[model samples]
Target chain A: MQQLPREESLRLLGSVPLGRLVFTQNALPAIRPVNHVLDGENIVVRLNDGATLTSIAPPAGEAGLVVAYEADAIDPHTRLGWSVIVTGYARLVADPSQVARYEELLRPWVAQTMNGVLRIQPDLVTGFRLVAQPAVAVCAAGGEGR
Target chain B: MQQLPREESLRLLGSVPLGRLVFTQNALPAIRPVNHVLDGENIVVRLNDGATLTSIAPPAGEAGLVVAYEADAIDPHTRLGWSVIVTGYARLVADPSQVARYEELLRPWVAQTMNGVLRIQPDLVTGFRLVAQPAVAVCAAGGEGR
Candidate 1:
C-alpha cells in the first residue's frame, strides 16, 4: 500500500461521485452511501430533512459535526484500487444562494427533495493505493506471496 | 430505497469479503478497506502489527474498540445496490488457537503476514437497498424520476 499526498488524495476523492458518509448516532456509528460533489475544498452532499445525518448534524454555531467521508474505486477482479478518506467538520449550508447553487450542480439520488445541504470542511485527508506486490519483491522482503 | 431486514442485511454482508472499516485516530475519523470473514456472529479482520488499526486499537480489558464496518455492491451504470453497516466493538483475538483458525480460513489481501486478529462484535446492523424507482410509480407520486 502506498500513501497518497494530500493533493493527490483530494483529486482522487473528487473523481468518484458516490461515497459513504459515516457518523455516530446515539453513540454508535452509522454509515450511509451518499452522492457528493466537490466544491473547491469542501465536500457537498444533500441529505433529506428527516434523514438521520441531517437530524444529527450540529447547529451552525456549535462545534461542527465531525464525520468521515470515504470514496474508492477498486476492481473486484484484480483487487487493485485507491481509497481516500476525509475527516471533517460538517455543518448545514444555510445560505439560500449557496443552497440553490448546489441543488443545480448536484442531483440527489433519492426521490425525496434534498432540502438539507451539508458541507464537510475537511481537516485531515489520507489515502492509500493497493498494488499487487511482485513475487521478486515479496521474496526480497523475506515473505511468500499468498 | 427500501430498508432491509436484519437477516437480509447479514446475508448481504456475508456475500462480500471486502469492506471498509472506520475508526478514530487522534479524535479524527479514519477508514481503510479490509478483507473480512463472517464468523458466526463476529466480523473477523487481520491487520499487521504496525498497521494504523492495530496501533490504535484499545488494549485488552478496556472498552473494546468502537468501529464501523461497511460493505456494498452497486452497479455503476444503474446506480442501484445494497449497503450494509455494522456498528461493533472490536477486540484483539489473543487466543492462539483462534488466530491460527482465522489465518487458515481467511486469506489476507496484502502480502504482509497479518499478525493481529481483531473480532468485531456487532451491536447494531442496518442496511438499505437503492432501487431505481419506476416511472409509473414516480408519476403516481406526483414527481419525475431522475
Candidate 2:
C-alpha cells in the first residue's frame, strides 16, 4: 500500500461526496455514512436533530468531540482503490449564517428533517492505496501458479 | 427507518463480505474496511501480521480489546438501505484450528500476507433500515412547489 501525502489526501476526500463518520456513543464506536461538503478545510454535514448522533452529541459551548471520517473509492469488482481517513474534532455549527449557507449547499440523503449541522476540523489526514503486486498479476495470468 | 430484529441483523451482516472495523489508536478512533466471514454469531476476520491492527493487538492470552464493527448495504442511486452495527471485544484467535478454518473460508482483498485471525464476540447488535417516505416519493413525482 502507498501512503498519500496530506494535500493529496484532502483532494481525494473533497472529490467524493459520500463518506462515513465514526464517533463514540456510550463508550462504543459508531459509524454512519453521510453526505458532506468541503468548506475550506472543514467538512460540513447535515445531521437530523432527533437522530442518534444528535441525541449523543456533547453539550453546547463545550470542547469539540474527537471523531474520524473515512472515504474510499474502491471498486467492488476488483476491490482495488484508495481510502482516506481524517481524524479531527467535531462540533455543531452554531453560526446561523454558516448553517444557512450549508443548508442550501448540502442535501441530506434521507428524507428526514435535518435541523443540525456539524463541522469537523481535521488534525490528521492519512490515506493509502492498494497496488496490485507483480507476482499476483503474473500468477493471475497463468505464470508461476500454473 | 425501521428497526431490524436481531436475527435479520445478523443475516444482513453475514451477507456482506466487506465491512469497516472501528477501533482506538492512541486514544483516537480509527476505521478500516476488511473482509470477514461469519462463524455462527462470532465475526471472524484476518489481519496481516505486520499490519497496524496487529501491531496494536493486546498481548496473547489476554482479554480482547473492545471494538465496533459496522456493515451496510446502501444503494448509491436511491440512498436507501440497511446498516448493521456490532459492538464487541476483538481478540487474536490463538487457536490454530480456528485460524486455519477462517483462512480457508475468507480471502483477503490485497496480496499481503495474513498471519493473524481475530474474532469479535458481539455484546450488542443493532441495525436499522432507511425506508422511503411518502413525502419524498410524492416530491420526487412532482408534488412539492409544483
Candidate 3:
C-alpha cells in the first residue's frame, strides 16, 4: 500500500458519488451511506428531515459539527483500489441561493424528500492505494530470481 | 430503498470481505478501510501495531469498545446495491488459540504485520437495499398506459 498526496486524495474523493458519513450518535460512533458532491474542497450532501444527521448538523452560524467521510473503490476480486477519508466540520447550509445551486448540482440517491443541505469543510484528508506486489520481489521471495 | 431483515443483512455483510471501521479519535469520528471476516454473529478484523485501533480496542476480560462496522456492494454506475451497518462493542482477542484460528482463516489484504485481532459483538444490525422502481410505479408516474 502507498500513501496518497492531498491533491490526489481529493481528486479520488471527487471521482466517487457515494460515501459513508460517520458521526457520534449517543456518544458512540454511527455510520450512514450517503451520496455527496465535492464542491471545491468542501463536501456537500443532502439529508431529509427524518434523518438524525440533519438534527445533529450545526446550523448556519453555529460551530460546525465534527464528522468523518470515507469513500473507496476496491475490486472485490482483486482487492486493488484506493480509499479516501476526510475529517471535517459539517454545517447546515442556510443560504437559499446556495442550497438551490447544490440542489441543481447533487441529486440524492433515494426518492425521499431532502430539504437539508450540509457542507463539510475538511480539515484533514488522508488516502491510501493498494497495489499488487512487485513481480521482482515476488520472484526473489520465491527463490526464482531472473 | 427497502429495509432489510437482520439475517439478510448479515448475509450481505459476509459476502463482502472489505468494510470501513468507524471509531472515535480525540472526540471526533475516524474511519478506516479494513478486511473482515464474519464468524457467526461476530465480526473479526486484523490490525497492525501501528494502527490506533489496536490500542483502543478493549483488552480481554474488560468491557468492549464501542465501534461501528459497515460493508456494502454498490455499483458506481447503477448505484444499486445493499449496505449493512453493525454497531457494537469491540474487544481484542486475547486467547492465543482463537487468534491463531482467525489468522489462519482470514488472510490480511495488505502486506503488513497484523499482530492484533479484534472481535466485535454486534448490538444493532441494520441494512438497506436500493432497488429499481417497479415498472407499474414508473408507468403511473409517467402517465403512460401499459
A best-first ranking of the candidates according to their DockQ comes to: 3, 2, 1
Q: What's each prediction's TM-score?
A: 0.85, 0.85, 0.90
Please write out the lDDT profile of model 1 over residues A42-137, one tens digit for every residue: 999888644666677864666888999999988655567888988889998877898899876666666566668889988889888878777425
Better-scoring candidate (lDDT), 1 or 2: 2
- Kindly list the per-residue Cα lDDT of model 2 for residues B49-141, writing each as its tens digit: 436667666634777788888888876556678889898888887777777888777766777778788889889899988788865455434
Candidate 3 whole-model C-alpha lDDT, 0 to 1: 0.84
| Runs off by more than 4 Å, candidate 3 | A49-51, A134-146, B49-51, B134-146
- Candidates ranked by lDDT: 3, 2, 1
Q: Model 2, residue B70: what's the lDDT?
A: 85
Q: What does candidate 3 score in Cα RMSD to the true structure?
A: 4.3
Inter-residue clash pairs, candidate 3: none
List each candidate's DockQ score: 0.37, 0.47, 0.50
Compare the candidates by TM-score and give the number of the best one: 3
Model 3 compared with the native: what TM-score? Answer: 0.90
lDDT of 2 by residue, A66-94 (tens): 99998887765566788899998888877
lDDT top scorer:
3
